[model samples]
Target: MRILIVGGGVLGTLHAWQAVERGHDVVQLESEPEARGASVRNFGLVWVGGRATGAELDTALRARVLWERIGERVPGLGFRANGSLTVVRTEAELAVAAEVAAGAEAADRGYKLLDVAETKKLNPALRGDFRSALWCERDAAVEPRVAQPALRAELARSGRYTWKPGREVRHLSATGVVDDRGERHDGDVVVFCTGAWTGGLVRELAGEPPVRKVRLQMAQTEPLGEELTTSVADGDSFRYYPAYRGPALETLEAGQPQSKVAQEHRMQLLLVQRLDGSLTIGDTHEYDQPFAFDVTEDPYEHLAEVAGALLGRPLPRIRRRWAGVYAQTTDTGRIVHRERVADNALLVTGPGGRGMTCSPAIAEDTAEELNL
Candidate 1:
């Protein structure tokens, strides 16, 4: 089968790789010479453990293994298996995290609930008022901007997939799809992996899926030279990836710690030390009808303050800031199966704010579906 994947971000590159693995000829068409969305602008946490709740836990574990395997296939793209620490500072926060841990245990999850002393032992750089934490030992992080392009290069080097950059696809034709230049290229399967830009192509299909465009603001700090290993999430970071809290937020009620915290501030700020010693953080979500990828630092100061409180250290000076737009579905879990588009084409989209970590499984599923 000849499969053409739309959008050159994480999903596009992943789909192309999976298709080639399934012995199908694949080409990924990216609008820009480089990715311009959430694919590059993210904390890059593979998120194996903090999301230790419900069926999603199992799915996350699978994604974790998939990430490790992908890392083995393509070395260096910053696939760090340092796990994640959901730190708790206050007694109330500890209580909430304990409940999350209990629920995860009831669900038979693979996470470790650690005391503050134990957490500090795991990552010595973290020093603050934290009392306890939930650790996902299998969690990993990847440098998307670097890892993704590297994956694409490896695919080409192995002679499996082809990537076409600066090839903005315009529309789908009866027999083929047209590019920005109105050039039509036919394929056995045409999949839409356009992330936030998916609506423009699938508007006429009446997709019942409630996919929305969300703007995420992220920033980086000057190099700290600290051995910061794992991804860290605090109270203000939940709005972006609520899966970290599991069903705790789902059943959170009035006057509850998490409920009150969530109402006052949509999320807790998260921090992750990149491979180069600089900390990457931020990420406040704002919805837009058609999202734009421009960043603002209005939220970073507060975010930095929270991170400083978490670390018990002065906040590092900001070096750069960026905003990326992502396609998000009302349902939190990832979308894997093919969407039944008119005629025979499938509109494959993953809008769970994790197009990179979750893309391998989705792409593999897409390739198998194309075989059918």
Candidate 2:
């Protein structure tokens, strides 16, 4: 089978990877020279700890396995099972962590309530004043900036995968697709993994998917002198992830509301160090469209303060700051929005922030469903 995958982001590249691995030919097209969307501009967290129970968690676990296997095959991925630490400062936050650690599926999620000593042992860089932390051993990280190129290079070696950049799909058909160059690429099946791009042919074909765009602001700093063994998040992250929701979380939210700036930006502090030792930190959520043309400094200020509080030191000089947008489903219950627009054409998108964590498993499911 010849699979034509539109969009060269992680999701589409993973689809190509899956098809080519199954001994099928694949051709993927990207509008720009390479993907410049939410795919590359993310924390590269293969996060399993914060995923909601059931299907979302299951997909994250499966994708984690796939990522390990693929990362072993491609060393450039920079995959590591470093896990994560959500540090808590107050008694309310500690209660929430305890609740999550005591949940029925806590074992599956690798949830452990760690004291100050145990937390410091896992990530010695954290010298801050915190009561305890929520440890998730199943979490991991990857190099999002280079993952696609690395995967495509491996797929190219298969001799059945072709990557065509600077080409956008202008029209779709049951048999294949037509690019902006007016060239027709034929295939037995066509899968559109377009991420956050809901305009042009996507709107024409799908007619306003059950998904919306989400904007976020992030920044990276100069290399830290020391190693940050594990990814770090503050207790505020409990407000963003569904897995932490419960009576305890509800009480924490009521008692300890977010800061004025944090509430204004819908912010959460997630910090991860890159292979070069630089820390990638972010982010604040913006749901309403027509996102700001300029990135604000208040959120970054808040992030720095929170991060400094966790590490017991000031952050390194910030080198870069940017904003990105991704597609998310309106219905929070659905993992992603997958629909068949034609007999041989299917649209799979709106994995939201889970694009990095769940792409591999999502593509695997797509293959099994289409019998490709």
Best by lDDT: 2
On TM-score, the candidate that comes out on top is 2
TM-score of 2: 0.99
Error of 1 at 325 (Å): 1.5
Q: Per-residue CA lDDT of candidate 1, range 1-372, in tens?
A: 777888787877777877777677777888888887888888887865544255456666666777788888888677878877878665555555666567635334446779878989887878877778877677788986697788887888767577788888777766658888777778877887777665555665545556767677788999877888778887434323444454444333223444333333344577888878899986666764555545544577677777887788977888988877777666555454347675657776644565666777667666666663
- lDDT (Cα, 0-100) at 90 in candidate 2: 96
How does each model score on TM-score?
0.88, 0.99
> Which ranges in model 2 have alpha carbons more than 4 Å from their true place?
none
- lDDT string for model 2 (1-372, tens) is 899999999999999999999999999999999899999999999999999998999999999999999999999999999999999999999999999999998999999999999999989999989999999999999999999999999999999999999998999877799999999999999999999998899888889999999999999999999999999999999999989999999999898989999999999999999999999999999998789889999999999999998899999999999999999987788889999988888899999999999999999999999887
List residue ranges in candidate 1 displaced over 4 A: 50-55, 104-109, 204-209, 236-265, 288-298, 331-337
Worst 10 residues of 1 by lDDT: 253-262
